[model samples]
Target: MSDILFTRTDERLGEFAVRPVRPAEDTALLHGWLTHPKSAFWLMQEATPEQVEREFREIAAAPSRAAFIGLHRGRPAFLVERYDPAEDLAQVHRSEPGDVGMHFLVAPTDTPLHGFTRAVIGTVMELLFADPWVRRVVVEPDVRNRAVHVLNEAVGFRALRTVSLPGKDALLSTCTRAQFAAAAGHAPEGSAAERGANR
Candidate 1:
């Protein structure tokens, strides 16, 4: 698809592909995900399809933000939003150069895989780092979302401190490229050949 950004396959999770969100065509599907009871942290439990459409349309039109749909084995499985932290998070947090803000939601599924959510988040981080300019990934997850805090640590995010946002107190966190490489247990980009030599 023209919108596809990249495709990756995790040994245990099958193939996952990401593409830009289509506001018109994806409104109904995204509305369901955002309103799911399990998506309480998303803070849009009562959003209608129209509201979802308008929200995503605005995101799609914004120059500093982008939304993507992640597909697993050709089926839509998650939603991701990437934004320039300097634009939205500046008021709440001091954004450094190369900071990128992210948010993600795994679509509610009847058959939930044990580590599917982790894989989705890992994929999202990798996609962000694929850009040469991104040196750090920043996230401000709700303080009440302990599950996500655990997940964020698994991906190398170190929680800084609680910060009050518009409605929720969020745990500000950051992950650098080096930290992610260490946690993910992979050689940094451009070190693959060096690893072969060392071995």
Candidate 2:
């Protein structure tokens, strides 16, 4: 088992844990998740085990990109990533000193549960703030993803602008630790220095 990043145990829902990705062991399941119709934004129609391994290996090799697997009751249930926004979007958005880019994919569950996706999104935001130098979490989700738009707002990210990427126009959004704390109804975790005193 890997180190746990975040977890919660509620009588109704059982335990949920978030940790780094192990694509070698999880390639098949992840492939299914990424190719599902609901995951169209993923843009990978079909991927072999070798392809998945290579991609994840490259992610692990790049210091600027990091991926994690989220577990619900000790089972892999979601995938999320964080990268230097400047690096990920350098071809488009000009690099900025403190921008961190992030994305998430929630696995399709056989048993649907209300608010599960929201909790997963909350955990991702919390993880981003875990770093001391992350001044802002930047996201460029497709403007058409209205469901995720609501989720982003629930976590205190406000729309900054609409920007066009290589293939799709996205709604750029950002959230700082203070904004997140207010939305989540809890003080930011870890050191306040991590949040920095910046707009």
Candidate 3:
């Protein structure tokens, strides 16, 4: 059975689920997504299937990282990765106790849905913040990827500054739990309990 981590519903997109990645089983599918022209910023355009399998295997074995496959209804639609900033991105930025780093990529479709990408990002943020200990989420996307910058803003990520990574200049950004709540239109975390008391 697929080890499902969580499930969420988007009003416009219906239901989607996230599950632990099965490296061996998911390699071909992931390879296709990462090599597509639209995935240029992912920096794996030339990776072979064997290479993809090896990479994911290492990720799965890492204690500070996790990879998830996003499923729309029942079909795979996207990928998500969560890592401990202290271990994964320490070279690029300072690590904090409650900080978690994230990366996601939506599968390319010939016909794209108007709000699909936004919904995907929102779901990813929601998943991260669902962990009570996660106070903030961090991302370092390629600076030249304008579409993602816009999406990041819409989801409440504030750009800090650009930093040169090994191969790409990345726009470092962060979103706090409260920021995500505001952007996602939910009341801030203690408000609901306060409201219940008032009632």
Candidate 4:
């Protein structure tokens, strides 16, 4: 069986999994998604499968960056990545010690799966919070992606500001572990009831 990163079923959602990208096996699918109009932000309009493989291999070989393929019930469905903004695309953004840059692209589907995209975002947040080193998660989605704007808000990501990047103007957003816990149907770490009315 393939290695999986996450496998949980929330009552409001369905089972999902995340795995590191296998460039050699997934390049064609990535090429198609990156070339599609909906994925214009990815900026690989003319990319061929070979180019996709080459690019993804380079990403996998990078030291401060990591990529993953998200699967919904064992089928590939999206690509996600995380990196250090200070050394990656936004070296001049004046990053802090806890800042991490993130990017995600949901693969086009034959039939749309309701709430699946939101679930993907939630799962990504869950992954981030799972790591104690990550106190905050940051994203630089294109300023024009209104759909993602709303979804991010639903997950407690507050807009920080708009900044210019290599290919587009990005609306910077952030989400902390506390914010995610609240959005994911959990209470804050400390509370009167949970602490049994202690001081």
TM-score of each: 0.92, 0.86, 0.92, 0.87
**Ranking of models by TM-score:** 1, 3, 4, 2
- What is the Cα-based lDDT of residue 163 in candidate 1? 88
Clashes of each: 0, 0, 0, 0
Rank the candidate models, highest lDDT first. Answer: 1, 3, 2, 4
Is candidate 2 or 4 superior in TM-score? 4
> What is the lDDT of every predicted structure here?
0.85, 0.76, 0.84, 0.75
- Residue runs of model 3 more than 4 Å from their true location after superposition: 187-199
Where does candidate 3 clash, by residue pair? none
Tens-place lDDT per residue, model 2, 18-109, is 66666688788878888788888877767676787778777877877878887888888889888887767766666566678898999986
Give per-residue lDDT, candidate 4, residue 3: 54
Task: Give lDDT tens digits, candidate 4, residues 1-199.
Answer: 5456555454565666677778899888888889998888888898889998998887888877777787777788888888877776565466777767778889987888788888788777765555556677888888999999999989889998888888889898888778877786783221111110000
lDDT of 1: 0.85
Model 4's alpha-carbon lDDT is 0.75
Each prediction's Cα RMSD?
Answer: 6.2, 4.6, 6.4, 7.4
Worst 10 residues of 3 by lDDT: 190-199
Question: Which ten residues in a row are the worst by lDDT in model 4?
Answer: 190-199
Tell me, by lDDT, which candidate is best. 1
